[model samples]
Target: MTAIVVAGGGLAGAAAAAALARAGRDVTVLERDAAPAHKICGEFLSVEAQASLAAIGFDAAVLGGHRISRLRLVRDDAAVSVGLPFEGLGITRRRLDAALLDHAASCGAVVRRGVAIRGVDCSDGLRLDLAGEAPIRPDMLLLATGKHDLRGVRRQAAEPEALVGFKMYFQLNPAARQALAGHIDLILFDDGYAGLQMVEDGMANLSLLVDRARLQRVGGTWTALLADLVKRNTLLADRLIGSVPLLEQPLTIFRVPYGFVHRPTANDPDRIYRLGDQAGVIPSFTGDGMAIALHSATRAANAIIAGHTASAYHRALRRDISGQIRRAAALYRLARMPLAQRALFGVAGTFPSLLRLAAQYTRVPPRARSALY
Candidate 1:
């Protein structure tokens, strides 16, 4: 059998490579970065993500990240706290991706770092064009580049009103730290919302999304936009009282095609398999992106092992997660509307179980039954 080539050594790529290599199929992972670095992500691992990681032979419990047992929604002064259906972990993508890729290497997969892919040509088999390197054509290819599109396989155009995202790390004051322990806070303000949670050490990850117009109106600078948001958001203001920023500046990602789901097309003659954000981009607030990546990795691996067509795999993944993605997108829209935000919060406050139910519905079905194994 010809070796399989996976682009982007991210959560999905590394996990899929590990699964395929462990099953005695040759696999190679190509990552552009020479070393692991932070990526723009919420970094919250749900139960499904954990199970998929375990199936890929990685132990998430040993990652030393924070334990998040509940989710709290805060809007100005009104707030509601609800129990999360499952305990989640707060670990950065930098750490998680590095560890999982290392696991792939240890599991007999050839892991190649600092190798950038220019594009893929499938007219005759699969030809991968590399930057300043010789091209190789493999039997099958898996595209796992998260939030990024390879030159040949980009997703459809994102909605015009795409949101801008920002992420920063901080060491909160004693009072704020104690108050935020064991919880993931989703704070809302005008035209945007933020999710803050503890991860690993005493450090906190604060990731926020703002409408593009709102960002442009504030001078199109991270500093200006963040200051305005903090002033308008009471809960976020309190959390940053005495915090020190860990990064010189926040990491930002652009052109995020939120709610994008890949459907097999006639142009996919290369039989390329799309994974992670390439497969679908669920709204970030739902915190199911990582789970989808892990689950997609295993499912894709299974498909290849079973000699299934790429279109068949794409259809199955789309069928499995389309409803969850749509529901989360609707919730994201409702959370942004001023009037609907208040009403949604009111309902969530009245029946906290509703929040749990939303979480359950937004998540792709668990893999324990299990297609992912």
Candidate 2:
């Protein structure tokens, strides 16, 4: 059997490599980073995401550092809290990535760290150019490089422009921690949305997602914009100000791009496949990015094991990922509209039951609604 080459050793790549190895295929994963690194994220997984993780036999205990049972939607002075039908897990990217990598290695995958992929040629089989080592040719090439564009792939012109993400860890006062325990708070303002949740080590993870223009309007620094947001949002100010202590230097990820690939490589139907963010990214607000990637990887591996062609894998990926992306995009677009945002949140706050119903809707699997009730 020909070896499968997976690029980017993040969650998606590692998961895909593991799945393929488990299916009795030789897999090699090339990662630029040597080990798990810190990343900026909400760190709160929805119930649906947890279910996906469980399906892959991942132990929830590894993510038990911080567990939340409530989801709070906040706007200015008013807030509505809804108890999640199921609990959500909170784990840092560092821990999650390390766990996935370890699992992939144990499953017989050859993980090559500190190796950067200079470029790829998919015309004749799959050729990968490494920075220091001689070029390698593999039977299949999987692109899982999250948010980073590779040179050969053709990106759609109509895709959404990348957004910026800012995050940091902090220690909160005992009173504040007590109030925030078992709850994930989402704060929405005119600029964008910010989320707060507790993670391992008795610290809270705070993240802000904002457009570049809005960041500029508030002064380039996220700290500056955050301060302004706090001043405008009294509830958030009261809960965090003077109580939360910064745990690490605030981190920022610029131009985190996302979109779909309309045209799969026509010339090379035998070798090329896209996975994870490289395939496309769902809006972060939906909290399903990692789950979608993992699910796609599994589906792709199954297709390969069944001896299906690359075109079949492409169609399957589109079918699985497009629906969720559309739903998330619609919700994100609605949130961007001032009037719609006000009305949606206003209605949600007025009728707590409605919020619960929405959560249920979000939690339902794509084709398993009959089983959900």
Candidate 3:
């Protein structure tokens, strides 16, 4: 049996491994982290994302531990709540990663936890250097490394520089929890936005997405930036003023670029495929990153199953996500413009239902609704 090696056993990697295993491919997944950890993610899965997972046979039990419901958008001091045309799920990355990894393993993929991939050499096949061991070569390579800059991968020069994001978990009061339950509150300001929600364990997830420039202006420390951000936004300040942080430290990452590869084929003779953030990123505003990754993984697996060439697979993946990417890019551009941002809030304040209408495209699935409610 031909074997495929997946680097980075996060959402994309685990999903890709599961898809491959389902297709009868022998798969190995390498993850740097051990079981059960949180990622600096929004933790709120949209309805569409949940639907995608359900289609892949993801277990509903994975989402059983949290609240589920529609999202509430807040702008200009006005809040608009809408039922996700579907439903959204909220689970900590700690729970989510473990569940995904377990699912991958159950599907017959070999998962190597605490194994970091040091390098990738794509020649006839792909050679992966593990931390202190001889390199292992596999028949095919899937780079789901996600957001970590690889030495040899070529990136588009025109792509916007990736922004930095920081998130920390917190235990909230019943009132605070109720305020956050079933709603992903997006607090928008100039240069960045913060998403607030309740996840598993009665904890609230506070995640911020900001440009590198703005982050630097705040001295590049989560403490400094978060303090300044709270001061600037009264809603956040009111909610978190005396709240204790659950994370020992805030999670941060930089330069997360989002775009499609004009060409997906590995031009470097590695025949290696990039998945998720490794492939390309979508803006977090849409909250579709994981969905895009899972969707792309399925597409890639199907292409390989049909014996399609790497280039052909790339084309198929591009075709699938390009439209959404284009729309996201346009929205990003608008968000960056001061007048547009103000105008957006103004309109949102006037027509609260608009936010709900916009969220329809981003709802989660029925099976995972408990987490978000």
- State TM-scores per candidate: 0.97, 0.91, 0.89
Candidate 1: where are CA atoms >4 Å away?
A: 157-161, 367-369
lDDT of 1: 0.88
User: What is the Cα-based lDDT of residue 297 in candidate 2?
Assistant: 73
Q: How many backbone clashes does candidate 3 have?
A: 17
**Model 3 agreement with the true structure over 174-285: per-residue lDDT tens digits:** 6677777667788777887788988777888888888788888989788889888877766677668668898799887666665544355446443567777766577777
Residue 237 lDDT in candidate 1: 83
The best candidate by TM-score is 1
Writing each residue's lDDT as its tens digit, candidate 2 over 137-187 gives 988888888766677754442545546788888777777688788988888
Q: What lDDT does each candidate get? A: 0.88, 0.75, 0.72
Output the number of the lDDT-best candidate. 1
Candidate 2's C-alpha runs over 4 A off are 157-159, 243-248, 258-269, 360-373
